[model samples]
Target chain A: MADKKTKNVFKKGAISSDFIGTSIAKHQSKTTIGAHNIFLGQVRADVIDNKTVAAIEYTAYEDMANEKFHAIREATFKKFDLTCMHIYHSLGTVKAGEICLFVFASSPKRKIVFKAIEYIVEAIKADVPVFGKEIFEDETHQWKVNK
Target chain B: MTINVKYFGLIAEITTCEKERILFTKKNVSEFLELLYLKYPSLKNKDFQVAQNQELVSQDALISGHELALLPPFAGG
Candidate 1:
């Protein structure tokens, strides 16, 4: 359950819906997985001080971010009866309405996957060293903070 | 000891560089930060955490690693 190897959890840009669909299709052969839960984080067009955010440019301490992601994966496996889990986050610019984060968890049962998905997503939000720069419509920018 | 210090997010904006090598003979995190504060005083006003060798450590932790990072609030989803 404790996976020792670290995997890269970052992508260059927005995670395409097609990619997510392909991922799901690939798992069809794994008939042991009875349920899959997914969490997609879309960039929001937030209006702040009359400025609308157009996109988010994400960056990270890659070495630390990957290690933290690996730790979260290991913890999730140990805590749940999940068959597998995958997490991908955008590293560069992700436009508003585009997917920036994708989390998928599969399990033999439905309940485990539901819980596992939430746990992984929350851990990523709180522990990962990824930063976001909100680019406003006027080309101005501000750092994003997790709430 | 020369430490490879990394800055991320707004921390990099404040330092004006993403990475730098600091010649530090410090004993702990606080001492190393004090040295940094003298060089970049505005960093003192920023909210960030310290990571030594890719692991978060307290301010009193010993400077045992060759790499250090200044990380701001995480916005990861």
Candidate 2:
């Protein structure tokens, strides 16, 4: 359980281009800060044992994923002093070499934004309850759950 | 008693189905897992976690005739 005083700032489900763009625009303010660091995680077509990955299909236990995402968001805010932060992860099918996650953090200083971005990305990858299915070029598929 | 159990990731592959109803006398999550491991010996070394009613729980948590989901660690961007 998280502390009641913390605020939840994450949105679950497949993130669309519009949502990503809008979140950035909304978080941009004159009084906020001077620097914003963004981390975009794009899927890659990796050759695994002579087989190239074609696409990745993502699935989630919705209720649990949402809870976990909220917890992560709150924890991130507590760990860093930032104006705002946003995390979006793809939920359905994402092709190789396409964007899968977009993380944005803004702060008054450039140094803080850089450190916050790194921390957020690491936490999301290590804690969130999201799964990916890797499809090979030949159409063979493999589920990729985090280690 | 029979309880519904759900599987995810590699565990799903071994069970060949994502969900099932198993009849067992186990009273806690750990005992249930021990029974499952006996039935599916291949799951001995696989990494997984348990959740009851969508809330993550420790292996020693008490669970009886409740909906539970087994999830492998997440691998998403």
Candidate 3:
């Protein structure tokens, strides 16, 4: 069935503030949620070899990445008291200081949302197979590695 | 066997293609990797993990199914 493919978490470019705001607004109808914690991963202007980073071009092994996202989502729900969760990542180019990842977790209480967001973000950094190519201001590039 | 191999990110840059159907004579992971290194010598110097049917497998394990992937270090946020 269609559900077997898992929900695609990738967006075409940088995640706009408008889209994020709209997502939050849509949750107003669900009166059960009392707290929401969001983590936005912004691209840093990293300076390497005296060159400053201008942007990052991202790519992934789509099939495997999707599966991993699904697993992470499932695990987060199992371990936390979450009412809902949503994650979005950028594909293609995202400029320095732009948002590339957005993780939103909501719960009935503030404490649970805080813990849930951190866990999900850390799991994503360590487990997902997404690659980032850092493009320098001079147009040269190098691969990005999370520490 | 005709093994379907997929390369992502930096690995794909070296291989010059995203996917290929390689004519593999070997059955185990090490032999298959050796054969790949023969075809693309630069790949031997790169860092990656091998996935068999979407699961990471050790070099000593046997290759199963038709699909395999070369995944570089994860840089996801």
Candidate 4:
């Protein structure tokens, strides 16, 4: 995505497989992009003290998170010869084994997309102010922190 | 100045409100945080970063924005 316009990367609930498929299909007209890399963040069913996580409810400082996403998009463009990029993150409740985050990057060369995708995802994990509450099977919840 | 302070994640759980308007006559972020600690004592023990006008600011940074946010650790993917 171009940095000239700020795009709201947050999506409600889990990002559907259909949406992701549609996004990939949309780029067919952009013939310049030869390589594409994607990163999908899935919620794990981690057991802590015998309680298993069932889902994650997300929240964010929307205005700031959008700003960080925009910065990351701009930085990725500056660092790589990327043709386009799209980032979508889930908000509200996302169940286990569901998709919560999707980062897609495209470039002319395979190597550029590989490095660009990782860079965008890592920056998102560190810079964005999006919060997650891990809800257990028993309904108890705990705040999640990036390790 | 009246600042609109917002709390997120566990920090909001402590404040029990997402956002509020406070009549703050503080000099810096630390001073403003002291006021918040007095109002919500549990917030003193929590870890967070202050954002002035949607940008992260240091504790020593002066209170210059009408909008402020208390953000906890990022778990975003």
Identify the candidate with maximal TM-score.
Answer: 4
Off by over 4 Å in 3: A1-5
In angstroms, the error of model 3 at B25 is 2.3
Which DockQ value does candidate 4 get? 0.95
Number of the top lDDT candidate: 4
| Per-model TM-score (chain A alone) | 0.97, 0.82, 0.96, 0.98
Which parts of model 1 are misplaced by more than 4 Å? A1-4
DockQ category of candidate 2 = medium
Candidate 4 versus the native: TM-score? Answer: 0.98
For each candidate, the DockQ is 0.94, 0.64, 0.85, 0.95
Q: Model 1 over residues A31-113: C-alpha lDDT tens digits?
A: 89899999999999999999999999999999899999999999999899888888999999999999999999998899999
The number of the candidate with the highest DockQ is 4
Query: Which regions of candidate 2 fall more than 4 Å away from where they truly are?
Result: A1-19, A145-147, B21-24, B37-41
Q: lDDT of model 1 at residue A5?
A: 72
Better of 2 and 4 by lDDT: 4
lDDT of 4 at A10: 96
| C-alpha positional error of residue B56 in candidate 4 after TM-score superposition, expressed in Å | 0.3
Question: For candidate 3, lDDT tens digit of each residue in B1-77?
Answer: 89999998899999999999999878899899999998999999899999998888999989878899999998987
Task: Between candidates 1 and 2, name the one with more favorable lDDT.
Answer: 1
lDDT (Cα, tens digit) per residue for candidate 2, span A1-147: 223343333334345678778877775554656788989888788898899998888777766666776777777778877877766777777887777888888777898889888888888777767778888999988778555
Sort every candidate by lDDT, greatest first: 4, 1, 3, 2
Clashing pairs in 4: A1-A85
